[model samples]
Target: MVLYLQYNRGMTPTEAGQIMMLQAVMMTICAPIAGRLSDLWGSRVLATVGCLIIATGLGILVQVNDRMPLVVIAGSMMAIGLGHGLFSTPNNSTAIGTVAAAKLGIATATLNLARQCGQLLGTAVLSLLIAIFFDGRSITPQGYKDFQSVAVWALSISLAFSLMAAWFSSRKG
Candidate 1:
Protein backbone atom coordinates (compact mmCIF):
# COMPACT_ATOMS: atom_id res chain seq x y z
CA MET A 1 0.00 0.00 0.00
CA VAL A 2 2.81 2.40 0.72
CA LEU A 3 4.27 1.42 -2.59
CA TYR A 4 0.98 2.02 -4.32
CA LEU A 5 0.57 5.33 -2.60
CA GLN A 6 4.01 6.47 -3.58
CA TYR A 7 4.40 5.16 -7.09
CA ASN A 8 0.84 4.97 -8.29
CA ARG A 9 -0.81 7.85 -6.52
CA GLY A 10 2.20 10.20 -6.63
CA MET A 11 2.15 10.83 -2.89
CA THR A 12 5.16 11.66 -0.78
CA PRO A 13 6.65 9.04 1.52
CA THR A 14 5.40 10.84 4.59
CA GLU A 15 1.86 10.80 3.32
CA ALA A 16 2.10 7.11 2.52
CA GLY A 17 3.51 6.38 5.92
CA GLN A 18 0.81 8.39 7.63
CA ILE A 19 -1.91 6.58 5.76
CA MET A 20 -0.43 3.20 6.54
CA MET A 21 -0.25 4.10 10.21
CA LEU A 22 -3.97 3.54 10.43
CA GLN A 23 -3.30 -0.16 10.30
CA ALA A 24 -0.86 -0.17 13.19
CA VAL A 25 -3.06 2.14 15.21
CA MET A 26 -6.02 -0.15 14.76
CA MET A 27 -4.00 -3.16 15.76
CA THR A 28 -2.66 -1.45 18.86
CA ILE A 29 -6.15 -0.50 19.93
CA CYS A 30 -7.58 -3.95 19.33
CA ALA A 31 -5.03 -6.40 20.81
CA PRO A 32 -5.81 -5.83 24.48
CA ILE A 33 -9.54 -5.91 23.96
CA ALA A 34 -9.21 -9.16 22.06
CA GLY A 35 -6.98 -10.60 24.77
CA ARG A 36 -9.58 -9.83 27.40
CA LEU A 37 -12.35 -11.24 25.26
CA SER A 38 -10.35 -14.37 24.61
CA ASP A 39 -9.74 -14.86 28.28
CA LEU A 40 -13.46 -14.67 29.01
CA TRP A 41 -14.92 -16.35 25.94
CA GLY A 42 -12.19 -18.67 24.65
CA SER A 43 -9.87 -18.14 21.73
CA ARG A 44 -11.53 -20.38 19.16
CA VAL A 45 -14.40 -18.15 18.06
CA LEU A 46 -12.41 -14.93 18.17
CA ALA A 47 -9.56 -16.45 16.24
CA THR A 48 -11.91 -17.75 13.57
CA VAL A 49 -13.64 -14.41 13.30
CA GLY A 50 -10.30 -12.66 13.05
CA CYS A 51 -9.16 -14.83 10.19
CA LEU A 52 -12.44 -14.21 8.42
CA ILE A 53 -11.98 -10.49 8.80
CA ILE A 54 -8.46 -10.70 7.41
CA ALA A 55 -9.75 -12.65 4.48
CA THR A 56 -12.34 -9.98 3.89
CA GLY A 57 -9.63 -7.33 3.89
CA LEU A 58 -7.61 -9.30 1.41
CA GLY A 59 -10.74 -9.77 -0.67
CA ILE A 60 -11.04 -6.01 -0.92
CA LEU A 61 -7.36 -5.73 -1.78
CA VAL A 62 -7.73 -8.23 -4.58
CA GLN A 63 -9.84 -5.68 -6.40
CA VAL A 64 -7.32 -2.85 -6.12
CA ASN A 65 -6.10 -0.82 -9.05
CA ASP A 66 -4.34 2.48 -9.51
CA ARG A 67 -7.63 4.29 -9.60
CA MET A 68 -9.01 2.86 -6.36
CA PRO A 69 -9.66 5.32 -3.58
CA LEU A 70 -7.25 5.74 -0.69
CA VAL A 71 -10.17 5.36 1.67
CA VAL A 72 -10.68 1.85 0.39
CA ILE A 73 -7.04 1.02 0.89
CA ALA A 74 -7.10 2.49 4.38
CA GLY A 75 -10.18 0.48 5.24
CA SER A 76 -8.64 -2.72 3.94
CA MET A 77 -5.48 -2.08 5.91
CA MET A 78 -7.51 -1.41 9.04
CA ALA A 79 -9.43 -4.63 8.56
CA ILE A 80 -6.22 -6.57 8.27
CA GLY A 81 -4.77 -4.87 11.33
CA LEU A 82 -7.94 -5.49 13.29
CA GLY A 83 -7.88 -9.09 12.26
CA HIS A 84 -4.28 -9.58 13.35
CA GLY A 85 -4.98 -7.80 16.60
CA LEU A 86 -7.89 -10.10 17.30
CA PHE A 87 -6.05 -13.23 16.25
CA SER A 88 -2.50 -13.01 17.62
CA THR A 89 -2.81 -12.89 21.39
CA PRO A 90 -5.63 -15.39 21.52
CA ASN A 91 -3.83 -17.81 19.27
CA ASN A 92 -0.70 -17.46 21.34
CA SER A 93 -2.59 -17.89 24.57
CA THR A 94 -4.31 -20.98 23.31
CA ALA A 95 -1.10 -22.52 22.05
CA ILE A 96 0.75 -21.70 25.21
CA GLY A 97 -2.12 -22.92 27.34
CA THR A 98 -1.91 -26.34 25.75
CA VAL A 99 1.53 -27.03 27.18
CA ALA A 100 2.50 -28.14 30.64
CA ALA A 101 3.88 -25.60 33.08
CA ALA A 102 7.32 -27.18 32.88
CA LYS A 103 7.28 -26.95 29.08
CA LEU A 104 6.28 -23.30 28.82
CA GLY A 105 9.66 -22.28 27.47
CA ILE A 106 9.59 -24.93 24.80
CA ALA A 107 6.06 -23.95 23.88
CA THR A 108 7.01 -20.31 23.50
CA ALA A 109 10.03 -21.20 21.39
CA THR A 110 7.92 -23.41 19.19
CA LEU A 111 5.33 -20.69 18.78
CA ASN A 112 7.96 -18.18 17.75
CA LEU A 113 9.44 -20.72 15.38
CA ALA A 114 6.09 -21.25 13.71
CA ARG A 115 5.60 -17.51 13.35
CA GLN A 116 9.05 -17.08 11.81
CA CYS A 117 8.47 -19.92 9.39
CA GLY A 118 5.13 -18.49 8.34
CA GLN A 119 6.66 -15.08 7.79
CA LEU A 120 9.49 -16.48 5.71
CA LEU A 121 7.13 -18.54 3.62
CA GLY A 122 4.77 -15.64 3.03
CA THR A 123 7.65 -13.34 2.04
CA ALA A 124 9.10 -15.88 -0.34
CA VAL A 125 5.74 -16.42 -2.00
CA LEU A 126 5.16 -12.71 -2.47
CA SER A 127 8.66 -12.23 -3.79
CA LEU A 128 8.17 -14.98 -6.31
CA LEU A 129 4.94 -13.40 -7.48
CA ILE A 130 6.59 -10.00 -7.79
CA ALA A 131 9.55 -11.45 -9.63
CA ILE A 132 7.30 -13.08 -12.15
CA PHE A 133 5.71 -9.78 -13.01
CA PHE A 134 8.20 -7.05 -12.16
CA ASP A 135 11.26 -8.88 -13.46
CA GLY A 136 13.63 -6.84 -11.25
CA ARG A 137 12.33 -3.56 -12.53
CA SER A 138 10.97 -0.64 -10.57
CA ILE A 139 7.34 0.36 -10.71
CA THR A 140 7.10 2.74 -13.59
CA PRO A 141 3.75 4.29 -14.39
CA GLN A 142 3.28 1.77 -17.14
CA GLY A 143 4.30 -1.07 -14.85
CA TYR A 144 1.71 -0.27 -12.19
CA LYS A 145 -0.58 -2.66 -14.00
CA ASP A 146 1.93 -5.42 -13.52
CA PHE A 147 2.33 -4.46 -9.91
CA GLN A 148 -1.40 -4.42 -9.43
CA SER A 149 -1.67 -7.83 -11.03
CA VAL A 150 0.94 -9.24 -8.71
CA ALA A 151 -0.66 -7.65 -5.68
CA VAL A 152 -4.06 -9.03 -6.62
CA TRP A 153 -2.70 -12.48 -7.24
CA ALA A 154 -0.74 -12.58 -4.01
CA LEU A 155 -3.55 -11.11 -1.93
CA SER A 156 -5.99 -13.62 -3.39
CA ILE A 157 -3.70 -16.44 -2.35
CA SER A 158 -3.44 -14.89 1.10
CA LEU A 159 -7.20 -14.59 1.29
CA ALA A 160 -7.52 -18.30 0.52
CA PHE A 161 -5.05 -19.15 3.26
CA SER A 162 -6.84 -16.93 5.75
CA LEU A 163 -10.09 -18.72 4.96
CA MET A 164 -8.37 -22.03 5.51
CA ALA A 165 -7.02 -20.81 8.83
CA ALA A 166 -10.53 -19.84 9.84
CA TRP A 167 -11.73 -23.34 9.04
CA PHE A 168 -8.93 -24.91 11.02
CA SER A 169 -9.47 -22.47 13.86
CA SER A 170 -13.14 -23.40 14.04
CA ARG A 171 -12.40 -27.11 14.48
CA LYS A 172 -12.33 -29.09 17.71
CA GLY A 173 -9.63 -31.38 18.99
Candidate 2:
Protein backbone atom coordinates (compact mmCIF):
# COMPACT_ATOMS: atom_id res chain seq x y z
CA MET A 1 0.00 0.00 0.00
CA VAL A 2 2.83 2.39 0.79
CA LEU A 3 4.34 1.67 -2.59
CA TYR A 4 1.01 2.22 -4.25
CA LEU A 5 0.60 5.50 -2.44
CA GLN A 6 4.05 6.55 -3.55
CA TYR A 7 2.61 6.77 -7.03
CA ASN A 8 0.44 9.67 -5.93
CA ARG A 9 3.62 11.67 -5.91
CA GLY A 10 5.56 12.51 -9.06
CA MET A 11 6.18 8.91 -10.04
CA THR A 12 4.24 7.49 -12.93
CA PRO A 13 1.58 4.84 -12.41
CA THR A 14 3.58 2.51 -14.59
CA GLU A 15 6.59 2.87 -12.35
CA ALA A 16 4.61 2.10 -9.22
CA GLY A 17 3.00 -0.92 -10.82
CA GLN A 18 6.35 -2.11 -11.96
CA ILE A 19 7.59 -1.89 -8.42
CA MET A 20 4.76 -4.16 -7.32
CA MET A 21 5.54 -6.52 -10.16
CA LEU A 22 9.13 -6.70 -9.03
CA GLN A 23 7.97 -7.59 -5.56
CA ALA A 24 6.07 -10.54 -7.00
CA VAL A 25 9.08 -11.71 -8.90
CA MET A 26 11.32 -11.54 -5.86
CA MET A 27 8.83 -13.37 -3.71
CA THR A 28 8.64 -16.15 -6.25
CA ILE A 29 12.38 -16.38 -6.26
CA CYS A 30 12.64 -16.46 -2.49
CA ALA A 31 9.97 -19.03 -1.73
CA PRO A 32 11.99 -22.02 -2.70
CA ILE A 33 15.00 -20.84 -0.77
CA ALA A 34 12.84 -20.40 2.26
CA GLY A 35 11.53 -23.91 1.92
CA ARG A 36 15.04 -25.23 1.72
CA LEU A 37 16.03 -23.40 4.86
CA SER A 38 13.03 -24.75 6.72
CA ASP A 39 14.09 -28.23 5.70
CA LEU A 40 17.71 -27.74 6.70
CA TRP A 41 17.22 -25.91 9.98
CA GLY A 42 13.87 -25.55 11.69
CA SER A 43 10.85 -23.50 10.83
CA ARG A 44 11.13 -21.56 14.06
CA VAL A 45 14.63 -20.41 13.37
CA LEU A 46 13.94 -19.46 9.79
CA ALA A 47 10.79 -17.65 10.66
CA THR A 48 12.43 -15.72 13.46
CA VAL A 49 15.28 -14.64 11.26
CA GLY A 50 12.96 -13.76 8.43
CA CYS A 51 10.75 -11.71 10.69
CA LEU A 52 13.77 -9.86 12.03
CA ILE A 53 15.02 -9.16 8.54
CA ILE A 54 11.62 -7.90 7.45
CA ALA A 55 11.38 -5.63 10.44
CA THR A 56 14.82 -4.32 9.76
CA GLY A 57 13.92 -3.70 6.15
CA LEU A 58 10.85 -1.73 7.05
CA GLY A 59 12.78 0.26 9.59
CA ILE A 60 15.40 1.08 7.01
CA LEU A 61 12.91 1.82 4.25
CA VAL A 62 11.44 4.67 6.22
CA GLN A 63 14.80 6.31 6.66
CA VAL A 64 15.90 6.13 3.06
CA ASN A 65 14.10 8.53 0.72
CA ASP A 66 15.77 7.96 -2.58
CA ARG A 67 13.69 7.35 -5.72
CA MET A 68 14.11 3.71 -4.76
CA PRO A 69 11.36 3.07 -2.26
CA LEU A 70 10.00 0.68 -4.81
CA VAL A 71 13.15 -1.38 -4.80
CA VAL A 72 13.34 -1.28 -1.04
CA ILE A 73 9.74 -2.32 -0.58
CA ALA A 74 10.20 -5.14 -3.07
CA GLY A 75 13.16 -6.44 -1.14
CA SER A 76 11.28 -6.21 2.14
CA MET A 77 8.30 -8.01 0.62
CA MET A 78 10.57 -10.76 -0.61
CA ALA A 79 12.08 -11.21 2.84
CA ILE A 80 8.61 -11.42 4.32
CA GLY A 81 7.30 -13.78 1.65
CA LEU A 82 10.29 -16.01 2.15
CA GLY A 83 9.61 -16.03 5.87
CA HIS A 84 5.99 -17.01 5.21
CA GLY A 85 7.02 -19.82 2.93
CA LEU A 86 9.50 -21.09 5.49
CA PHE A 87 7.28 -20.71 8.48
CA SER A 88 3.83 -21.72 7.22
CA THR A 89 4.19 -25.25 5.96
CA PRO A 90 6.70 -26.39 8.50
CA ASN A 91 4.93 -24.63 11.33
CA ASN A 92 1.66 -26.29 10.39
CA SER A 93 3.39 -29.60 10.21
CA THR A 94 4.93 -28.99 13.60
CA ALA A 95 1.57 -28.08 15.05
CA ILE A 96 0.02 -31.26 13.77
CA GLY A 97 3.03 -33.18 14.83
CA THR A 98 2.68 -31.90 18.34
CA VAL A 99 -1.02 -32.53 18.67
CA ALA A 100 -3.09 -35.65 18.45
CA ALA A 101 -4.85 -36.45 15.21
CA ALA A 102 -8.26 -35.93 16.78
CA LYS A 103 -7.30 -32.37 17.74
CA LEU A 104 -5.92 -31.35 14.35
CA GLY A 105 -9.10 -29.58 13.40
CA ILE A 106 -8.97 -27.45 16.53
CA ALA A 107 -5.35 -26.71 16.00
CA THR A 108 -5.88 -25.52 12.47
CA ALA A 109 -8.77 -23.37 13.55
CA THR A 110 -6.70 -21.78 16.26
CA LEU A 111 -3.91 -20.99 13.84
CA ASN A 112 -6.25 -19.39 11.37
CA LEU A 113 -7.96 -17.37 14.06
CA ALA A 114 -4.70 -16.07 15.41
CA ARG A 115 -3.60 -15.05 11.94
CA GLN A 116 -6.84 -13.20 11.26
CA CYS A 117 -6.76 -11.43 14.60
CA GLY A 118 -3.24 -10.22 14.01
CA GLN A 119 -4.18 -8.98 10.56
CA LEU A 120 -7.16 -7.15 11.95
CA LEU A 121 -5.10 -5.48 14.64
CA GLY A 122 -2.46 -4.42 12.16
CA THR A 123 -4.99 -2.96 9.75
CA ALA A 124 -6.77 -1.06 12.48
CA VAL A 125 -3.60 0.44 13.86
CA LEU A 126 -2.28 1.38 10.45
CA SER A 127 -5.57 3.02 9.52
CA LEU A 128 -5.50 5.05 12.69
CA LEU A 129 -1.96 6.24 12.10
CA ILE A 130 -2.62 7.16 8.52
CA ALA A 131 -5.68 9.07 9.56
CA ILE A 132 -3.71 10.94 12.16
CA PHE A 133 -0.60 11.68 10.11
CA PHE A 134 -1.66 11.76 6.51
CA ASP A 135 -3.70 14.90 6.23
CA GLY A 136 -6.24 14.97 3.41
CA ARG A 137 -4.00 17.35 1.57
CA SER A 138 -2.55 16.38 -1.78
CA ILE A 139 -0.44 13.26 -1.52
CA THR A 140 3.11 14.36 -1.84
CA PRO A 141 6.39 12.43 -1.51
CA GLN A 142 6.64 13.67 2.05
CA GLY A 143 3.16 12.42 2.85
CA TYR A 144 4.00 9.02 1.49
CA LYS A 145 7.21 9.06 3.51
CA ASP A 146 5.24 9.79 6.64
CA PHE A 147 2.98 6.87 5.86
CA GLN A 148 6.03 4.64 5.44
CA SER A 149 7.44 5.74 8.79
CA VAL A 150 4.21 4.92 10.57
CA ALA A 151 4.05 1.58 8.81
CA VAL A 152 7.55 0.71 9.93
CA TRP A 153 6.58 1.35 13.53
CA ALA A 154 3.61 -0.95 13.20
CA LEU A 155 5.61 -3.67 11.46
CA SER A 156 8.27 -3.54 14.16
CA ILE A 157 5.70 -4.30 16.78
CA SER A 158 4.26 -7.11 14.72
CA LEU A 159 7.69 -8.59 14.25
CA ALA A 160 8.21 -8.63 17.99
CA PHE A 161 5.18 -10.84 18.34
CA SER A 162 6.35 -13.09 15.57
CA LEU A 163 9.73 -13.44 17.27
CA MET A 164 8.06 -14.37 20.48
CA ALA A 165 5.93 -16.92 18.71
CA ALA A 166 9.00 -18.42 17.12
CA TRP A 167 10.71 -18.69 20.46
CA PHE A 168 7.74 -20.34 22.08
CA SER A 169 7.32 -22.76 19.23
CA SER A 170 10.93 -23.82 19.49
CA ARG A 171 10.82 -24.52 23.18
CA LYS A 172 10.80 -28.18 24.15
CA GLY A 173 7.60 -29.27 25.76
**Candidate 2 lDDT, 1-173, residue by residue in tens:** 44444544355767656655654665567667776766777677765565565555555544444455555666766666555555565666566668888998998899899889978988898777767777556556657667556655666666676667657655633
As a TM-score, model 1 comes out at 0.92
Enumerate clash totals for all models, in the order shown: 0, 0
lDDT of each: 0.88, 0.63
Indicate the residue-level lDDT of 55 in model 2.
Answer: 53
Q: What lDDT does model 1 reach?
A: 0.88
| lDDT at position 172, candidate 2 | 30
lDDT of 1 at 79: 95
By TM-score, the best candidate is 1
Report the C-alpha lDDT of model 1 over 21-123, residue by residue, as the tens digit. Answer: 9889888999999999999999999999999999999899889887788899999999999998998889989999999999999999999999999999988
TM per prediction: 0.92, 0.68
lDDT of 1 at 101: 100
